[model samples]
Target: MQRVRTAPRHIAFETRPAGKPLDAEWTQITTREFADQVSAFAKGLIASGVRAGDTVMIMAPTQYLWAVVDHAALFAGAVVVPVYDTASPAQLQAIIADARPVLAFTGTAVHGERLAQAATASGTEAPQLRLLDPDPAIPNDASLAGLAELGTTVTDAQLEERRLAATLDDVATIVYTSGTTGDPKGALITHRNLVGQVLNTAAAYSEVVQETGNTVLFLPLTHVLGRALQLICIANGMRVAHLSDPKEVVQSLAILRPTFLVVVPRVLEKIEDAAANSAREKKVLPLWRAAHRAAVAWGVHLEAMDRDPGARAPLGLRLRHALFDRVFYGKLRAVMGGRIDYLLSGAATLRPELARFFRGIGVPVIEGYGLTETTAPLTGGRPGSLVAGSVGTPLPGNAVRIADSGEVLAKGVGVFAGYRNPVHTEQAFVDGYFRTGDLGSLAPDGTLTLRGRLKHVIVTSTGRTVSPESWEQTVEQHPLVAHAALVGTDRPYLTALVVIDTEAATAWFRDRGDAPARALTEDGLVVCADGRLTEEISAAIHRANAAVSPSERVQAWEAVVIGEDRASEFVTPTMKLKRQALLDEAASITDGLYR
Candidate 1:
């Protein structure tokens, strides 16, 4: 397994079963077949009016079609715009208008029709839309079927020419950010940008991958994290097992047994809660608690062993590992396929307590940071370089600096070529560095310690400033709290609106002999309803507030009883707080405070 410097001639390469190793079954995509599909799709796209430099919008779930559509579009010298399949009609329309795509590849007729209707409603002329189902036998419109039929006649020469003609500077894709404020902006990324990120990431984790051959693909392909993972797999010849449903992640892991997984903090938090709940239900918590104490004791001894390179673990700890396998590590590992080399958590800050706990249990969780504009990751922790509270050193060829105002600025080839709108593009970059809007400082060792977002900072009337994001992260870490939003910019003190983690809250009520009620209402406050706060909850909020300065502490608070699946009034799709929206909804509360 050598490091690959150049992109493969066929972006879709041959993959086959490595029969000798049973675990290598996931690496089954053959280069021949992949090349055939790429060639055929590219020809059909061109035959259907797609041309060089044209834009193609791709809206589909994480599946083989996503890869096909992206590669085919690239081969035809077209810019690709990948949209989340779950995007609202309004969001889809906005992206379509901004990109002004010449064609759209969709997963179903309903989705295509929705896009069409949205375009008509928005009064924007739409491109030719085509839909293809996962099942080949499903009948499609004559136009789409005709394109699909041409797959059989595409030649290898066409794919080769397309690849040869593609320059490193050519725009490969336009990724729209899940806007926290307004319509998402398209970030133009070239082939060089993506390839650089993949290569740099691969280099950072080469040691871990040297011993493992598989990586799990679960993030949305619409996101840069997912797209980067796909490229890394292709560049490194690693196998991928795609999982879309969050509920099926553990089950999929059992089947795929991937060596590594790149996931968001929410996913890891869910696993932690599930494991804890399982332990409690099985009456293993007490025993596991004792085991945890012993594990800590054994950890100290292991540290001593490390001082002597040739030393081995003592007999007592070895016996404990065997005895506690089922109660502790075994169950935890089973949920993660029992074979993960390392887990990379990004997209959001992971609680340090959770990261340390996972590491103590033999699962190393590395927390990192990046954005869509940075092509997913600018910094990540390596094996021994793991930092519990910091997003590790910047990737090779990347430079990170802190502005005077504490904003994190980055410059590198991995940085995107500005937003599609010139005004946004101008505002995004300061000098040549992309202003990340995140406030952070660089450690002596180069690790980036994230504080919070500059734009999200709350300034009190007394002139004290606070980053509500840090408090939000702290509150969300609680088992009962699913999401949190901190408010009070020029008022008395900070207050939060929180959504309970539904499953955890239901179980919490069930254990107390209470029948679970229907989902909480959006914008409905979740106080005691008797107009009193519980001592336990009060203590928790006080503790969270104590972590910040006195002026930043919550003087008053209320929870909105939002339904689990309803359009979140206080949160965005990426789970970012919709601060302005929350402020607007809580106007009555704020006004009452003043009186």
Candidate 2:
């Protein structure tokens, strides 16, 4: 309503029609149009026996329909629940058993079926199921059009009464955490938590959420940060386009040419890797390497300058950077729409070099830090202070501190009321601050530099404690290395299960333009046992080792050529390594090296 009042004609959202070209012009939805639709859907919800405080589960990808349903649920004064589209039937069942919503809506037949099965197994009556995108295959109460038809019976006064009855203190959503190291727990996020966070974040980082600025949302709405950002776009009336599929990111960017974009570290890594692999294929590896060095150098210089006013780049470095910007950087920018100013990254740490390279290319990454309990961001990059390695300072009205045990503690408006399970909620907080379970240090200015997850710390048989983050992140930055999971708990020393970047590795090997490369598919991911690629892996390990003491250095590692299996058993849907699963196999692979 406020968005409509301020910007009646402003395009609040954009969406591409299904089966359309990725670069096609988006279908814009104005503020008034979106509000009218949401109101109609809310009337339908109320007419269908939904009352205030009732839960509505949304299990779908990031799409326009998902946004409409989310707002509509809020308009009806119901508590919304989000489930990732990647969820298996079992995971879906677990959350359904926990949340026990009154209705559920999904974008596809597969998720609809999964939710149906989950609800059946939840041991309670199944919720009223609806489809956002109409599916004849899966039976449902109604589709979007059918819901609008249902709303014609409900009066405007009824919808208003329901919407106004809800309060900020009421539980607005039950957000389940991504189970990286443990089981997903339902965190009860109140309206205050959600609205307070977006308002404060917008005030603190107005540059990112400006009215004229726009961005594409590719991350799943199941994540707290994704939902928070969606709300921010609505509250600020920022133009937003939805891209459900990650594969179409390039085309979407080329078409939208947004001012800033939201991203995770993995996205940044893949972008740089794609460029490098393209260079290798074109026989311009040497030129690309020189340009890459210049970009990283330039980024490092800028970061130094950001921290200290007097810091400056050398004359030679400046000359090299300018030359490379014209010769190489411009082309790279062209691939990503040529208008990106900043990338907002969260959920994981970005390696220093990777972060610097992007900044060098003129798109600085603004890394933020928080969890589901924090309602997305506890700390984020301010406009003027961009810490290259840190997760910026706390947002307005939020505070972060390190406990005696090195765990990060947070207390703020963004912090959720509590977890759905009271016992879990009790364990999550200390005296007043929520136990973040992340180990981080705060500078005098309040910038937070994280070490690693407190639970991720590894202990060797020799009684030495090692945080695997630095080693894993350093190794992962290598062009050929996709992911590295360090394992050494109660063992003699550390070793890693390294995932070789098959696509990048194949391009690297095929640059010879020889018969071997032509027959590479039959060869099944050849790693060149004694060639430059092997040497490079060794060099990456060496670099990783240099960052740690003798005991903490990864002594040896086994390369796992992962392909087709995007998220194999060793990795979660979020791309986090299932450490316990790796630890189970670590002994089998590392017995020879340690023995």
Candidate 3:
């Protein structure tokens, strides 16, 4: 990739509205206006006693206010600590205490008040709190107007002073881990680290603009993927549209007609589900079946085409393209802007079957790997260089190596400075390389294949070290299981704590003449009106478990009802399991096996 010297001057760090004609097509915010808002918010923050280097916590959903508050804190030379919107009060309290923030910006009055109470309960130093709106009024308190009202016009002199004081080496943000595995730790990221990561990512996806012309942003901004993509968009001079609702994505695609997109495995799964259901509804029609088969066949052919550069296209390829374009490709494209040059998937592993299915439908799912600590996207499969099941080669300036124990080690300019806790910072690195804790191999073609996290490995008493993530992925692929965590560390056999997809489970029961007349509830089990495994449900679990090794097979399992009021059970923002909390609550079921 050629390095370009023409960097945009004046930083233009915030969203700027594209001039008229395109104005109504996007949410408009100019660079000057963005700077003024940041300056005003910084002044208000300073008056509230937030000093340089002090942490300012932000716990909010995706909104323009989130972007404003984050940039304001950075401009003020203060470190920003971003908290997930879905985090519980206790989780928020823990992070606030650990970071010892001076002030916090929350999404609503309810969460803001709850945070204050949680801090008091934890006996931690409570920071000054400002409520963002709870009543959902027009232009809520979290709106840009609300923040602008907090202070008067900031002078040019003041802006210059703040800008001059800011340094690239300074700690810009402290993003806490989602705590899916254990306690969350803040990953300390410097300005330079983030800037480098954006530059590197832009280089990899440069073809998206040169080839396709547009990109869409839908991931949560608090996470690394969203954060990094924001910077990449600015640096690449690309237009970005943010959508908070996943359901609105297809509609947005129709309007925006984005050429590229960043997505998670869950979103792709939904798309596949939609397509399959549509096909099933039209199955009775003979022409529908023929069209569907042709589309599926064409999808398979497209996947083959992707694999070989010089493969001759069969004459049937063109015929099917013309025949299936309206019924298949057109619908798929309508849901995805119909002109996407590439679709990038990360945060979790993409099932091989799903990847192939999408590739067959003409949308290439390029899987990548990274963490919050690496500012995301350490490795990505380039447009023409993609391989199934492997996160493509490391980005330029990033190095990847596998340890004897199979732990993946990464070293690069994009690597974060360290975790906020000094002890964790020291422990996370081994001989200067960041110990990713993830186990994976570097393939012969430079692609990276993730095995599982080292800490989550289940070591059987018989001496086999099995990665539950490997098995968990397969289990989750089952239609009934929404999410599954394979548990059984140091045990004879594994046991799964499964969260059944309530929608699919409901349909499964209905088809078997076992639909619940009313809701049935129980601990460690979900039942219809009649008490039983709902027929074939247990069989599905057994079949999923049967696919794994004997030691890794789930011996006993519990059904996780969707709306259960389990306080500490569920994944964190990054989608990692909260193992300690789950194990504690399920101790009775697990303890008997050890005895």
Candidate 4:
């Protein structure tokens, strides 16, 4: 925090209007200005009875204000607790009860009202609420602007004293998990964990973390991954633009021309799909297909060279790729603002195909592995030594090992102290290492290759265990698949419930001039008696099955239509499918597959 404050000449953050191009009139906050705002907010929080150890919850999306308040709370010697704005009222109430924050910040009035209602329902006094953007949608006790005014009288010495009084061992945050398993558990993160994360990330990425660059952060600050990036950007003195809404990311990308990006895999996939769709719309499908094939071939050749430096791409393919790069890859890169030099992806595995395509086109996606409990990254890919399928070696200062049960265990300064639940915390560690509950293996060079979540694995009646995630990754690669879940827990064989990517499927049918099967339904892609679409989907299924072992191959599958409501039921906010939740909701369809 102090380092950023001293770098007054540096633009700390750039806040752009929603839906506007990045160059459109945007507010730039210099490091000095950011520090002043944080100082004033810290004073406001302090004057409002916030003290060391008090929890201050920020229930909002990613934005400049959210970052300010988070820093201010820390400066005021208080613990920060962040809740996802998309969280249900019940989840909100549960977190409120657990953290018992003395003050809370909400991005919008709707969230303010929800928090108020949840507090009332929980029979606890609602925390003093401040709004990031106060509108008439709900009542707010005071606006962040108003709070900043209230804090104008605070002096720098007061803020410094508060900062000095706190130790690294002090609790800094209680980041609640997204609750894919059950109710969310608040993981206790201390000042040390935050510092360790920054230090280790810098060590792992070398200059990537230390060098200043232009970046756009769209990940929710509520998640540890997002929170870590926010802090890292500030600490590294990067010029950053914040996007609260993910939908605007693509448009903003072209305008921002960010040199570096931190993202989830879904965003990359969306970009790939959009690029393909754009090509088709422009009457250049043939060109796009040729470029894609060349990119894949180029990527393969590069990988081979990584293994054997003397290796080279066949001259014919190399020449074709170079020609296509000028025509296709250059245009695609412009969609990402054309300046992206590197990317860091986490939260889930990045598909190797997507990774290869981006790298082949010049923007390398460095996949990393970590969980909420690990404070963001335990393992990360290096700049030039990236292994497509592996999340490169553990970040410096972190040690990873696979347990006898195949669960990954991590011991590091970045690991969280424990969950808020005493018993849960007690069971989370073994021999001082945090049990990640993720199954993975370490390559000879120590790169981590994640397989699946232990709890999400399916065991068939024949005693064959399969990682649904591995199959799902391969299945979802098909353009028509919106989502897929493999099911067969204790059943005879594995089957899948697939959701169609409606727009893509519609385009597929329209392009083929086969319009009349049955309009895509809310129930999902309806199979025609013997239509080309059905045959294509079957072929996709066969391709996915071929990628896995016979025992793990999907035997039977059914496509289920998921309306907006059903979409939420099938996937977590983080985009991870809740296997049990989805299966229970689609019990009839799942059972029919076996019959």
Candidate 5:
């Protein structure tokens, strides 16, 4: 509202039409235009009998209208529930039953049908359905245009009556957790929660936030961090755009030439992989490899100097870095639109080496940490304080304390009100601090370095404890090693169930005019029997093993190839590995290793 009043004509968003070419001109949506859309939609929602505290479901991709409906629903004194476009039927049914929205909105006819089916499957009354993007063929319920027609019956006074009834403490959204371990629980994010994050981020990164540079958001809007970052962008007067499909992100980054990006570790992995593949195809693989090494070296040098004031980068290292900056780093930056200064990563732990690699190439990857209960961001990397392995220092008002049980605890303005379920809420907090379930240690400088999840800590037969995440992340740095899960609970030695990335492995062989040897495991899954592939994987494991004790190192491992469906069962949509699920279901794969 303040933006509309102050700078009504300012461009708030830019979007390219679907099916448009990459070079096509983007359509601009201004602040006043967006604000008006919100007001009219809120009136329509009110006219359609939506009341204060009613849950309004918006199931769709990240786009302009998602922003409109989200704001409109909240403005009408209703709570908004964002559902990811890729949600499965089972997942849909579970959320629909729990949220019990009074009105549901979908961007496509297919999603509308899915919602209707899920509502039926859950045995819940179907909410009044509405289409976000109008389609003449879709039957049932009002479209956005049709909603405007209904708004004629609603008066300005009536809309204001419900809107004014909202309070800061009221639940704005019930964001469901990714549910890697168990059922998804709704974390109660209040209006205050969102505002608090925005304020703190703006304070911490004033120049980074307030700059007039544009950014493209590709993460799912259903993600709490995605939604919160959008708000922070608006608060800081940055022009924003959306790309619903993450696969198209590289092109969007080049097209938008964004000043910064917010993404998870997987996205960075993809970006690096894409660059490496392009280099391989162009026959510049060796040069690219050298550039990568130089960049990483520079990053390590920078971090050492930052930590120790008396330390300085050697002249030889600095000169070589400068050469790589011109010869290779510039082109790498061009792929990222040539203007990105910051790469804000969150949602999962980022590998330390990847952070160093990017930071060395003039793009500092600022890893941050938070959960749905923190409303997305509680800590973020600050300039001059970035530590490669640490997520960052706590934000302006948010602070974390380590519990005796190795859990990260927090209490702050951005802390969520509580969980939606009373039973879960009772177990969620201790002495006013929200239990973060993650285990971490804080650097002397206040930056936080996450070890792994508390529940994932491995206890071996000899009573030796191991943190499998660091090992898994390091081994996964190999493009061929898609996923790694360390196993050795109550066993003599640690073994692993490593999932081979068949696509990448096959491509590598094909590019080299060779083929991978193949065989079937006892459990019937395909295994790449090529010695080269095995050697490559063994080399990666060796690197990871070097960082661990003899007992914690993976002595033997089994390789199995998995497709998307099988992989989905073991990982959340965000690519977070479900350790227990993998160990339980794939127990047979590694059984032969122990014998």
Candidate 6:
């Protein structure tokens, strides 16, 4: 808040006014103006009887207003509880029953109505509802603007006092897990936890602050990584743009031309696909493939030299890499607004091949690892000190170690306090370190390579224990596969449920002029009406199986194409497949495979 007051010209977010061309000049709000808005919103909460420690629910999409309300709630000395906008009614009811927030901010009319219905169904009074973006057409509900109007009644002195009253140990947020196994448990995050994230991120990636002029954040603010970046930007007084709709990302990137980005692997994969498709369309597939190979080679050489500064790239490879930079890499850079220096990837493990490809193109992607319980990232790759396959060293004051059982345990200032359910909280910690439940090994150099979730390990009937993550990683690398989940739990052999990348698969078929209009449905089968599509999937499975050990190989598999019927069949919002959910959904398919 003080930083905002100091840097008045620092652009916070770009606002595209209604009825204007997207390419038109964006309305810029400085830190000073944004601070005032936050202060006003904070005052409104206080005027509405919200007090210190009061739980305020922010159930909305990623937008500037979401950040405003989030900061406002915190400034009002309230503990925030973020609810995913896509959460089911029962999930909403469960959250409402648990936290019972004094106030709730909804993204749209549909979300507001869902909350009201969920509250009524749960037999609990609904929190004071305010629409983040109220439609004038439907003026029945309260608006965020109205809430801000209420804030004008409170004086600045009172607001300042309340903001200053918060301490480091105070509960800042209760972020719920994706709940793949069972009910979602709220992880208690503190002001100290958040502060640690900001300080550590800045220290680790200072180049992101110094050289990168601005950043664009599109990830859901409900997620800790998004929230962490928000705080990092504010702390460093850097310019930022908060993107609301994911569809507008490309346009916004072209318009804002941000220098840095925080994203998931899915975003990069889409960009890579778009670039590859463009090359194929232009009949320059061979040239593009050559350039890609050159880039990966250059990236590998650079990483080798980075590890051992005395090392150097071979003359032939270096010459080819330099040639491609001028011919191919330049065009790829233009796709990302032509100024992106770094792409920080998290939430899901990034494919090293993709990371190398991006780096080969001159846009370095640094991967990180963490969960909601550990705030954002306990360990992340540093900007200048790049590691291709590793989630870099632990943050400044954090410690990451592999247990005898191979689970990754972390002790850090960024670690969450506990779960909202006391018993779960008690179980979450073991010997002072937070049990991440993720399996990984830390190198002597402090780089970490994640294996897979402990609970998601598949134990075959033959007594072979396989971590499906490695196999899934290989399968997803196939151009046709959007998602892959391995299943064998106590079965004879490993089987998989694959989701076809409709666009990529369609293009692949059309390119070959074989059943160009072939389509896949949500039906649980690998063979589409066009057997060629099924053959393509089978070939991909063969590639994946060949990469793993004989015992860990995917022996039998089926494609479960996602559609309206199977809208969130197995994947979480972050695109991580839910092992248990996938198993339950594909029970019949797996049984048939065994028979």
- Compared with the true structure, what per-residue lDDT tens digits does model 2 show for residues 456-519? 8989999989888888998898878877888888888888777676676776666655333232
Model 1 vs. true fold: TM: 0.87
After superposing all C-alphas onto the true structure, candidate 3 shows an RMSD in angstroms of 5.0
lDDT of every model, 2 decimals: 0.72, 0.82, 0.70, 0.82, 0.83, 0.82
Stretches off by above 4 angstroms in model 1 are: 1-28, 135-146, 151-154, 210-212, 289-326, 518-536, 568-574, 589-595
Residue 592 CA displacement from its true place in model 1, Å: 4.9
How high is each candidate's TM-score?
0.87, 0.93, 0.85, 0.93, 0.94, 0.95
The model with the greater TM-score, 3 or 5, is: 5
How many pairs of residues collide in each model? Answer: 7, 0, 4, 2, 0, 0
- Which residue pairs show collisions in model 6? none
Top candidate, metric lDDT: 5
lDDT: worst 10-residue window of model 6: 521-530
lDDT of 6 by residue, 1-595 (tens): 6675566767766766644666877788888888888888899999888999999999998877888899999999999998888787778889989888888988887888898899899988888888887466645337877778788889999998999898999899999887777778989999999998888878888887652378887888888888888888878866777776665777677678888888889888888877778888899999888988888888887788777888888899888888888877887788678998889899988988889999988899988888898898899888667888789989887889889999999998889999989999889888999999999998888889988889988888888888888888888877778888888888888888787777677678778886643346344333343467667667778888888888888767776665544444456666666667767766887787788
**Local distance difference test, candidate 6:** 0.82
User: 417-496 in candidate 4: lDDT tens per residue?
Assistant: 99999999999999999999999998888889998889988888999878888778877877777778888988999988
Collision pairs in model 2? none
Q: Flag clash pairs in model 5.
A: none
lDDT of 5 by residue, 354-377 (tens): 999999998998889999899988
Candidate 4 root-mean-square deviation in Å: 2.8
lDDT of 1 at 105: 82
Poorest stretch of ten by lDDT in candidate 3: 1-10
lDDT of 1: 0.72
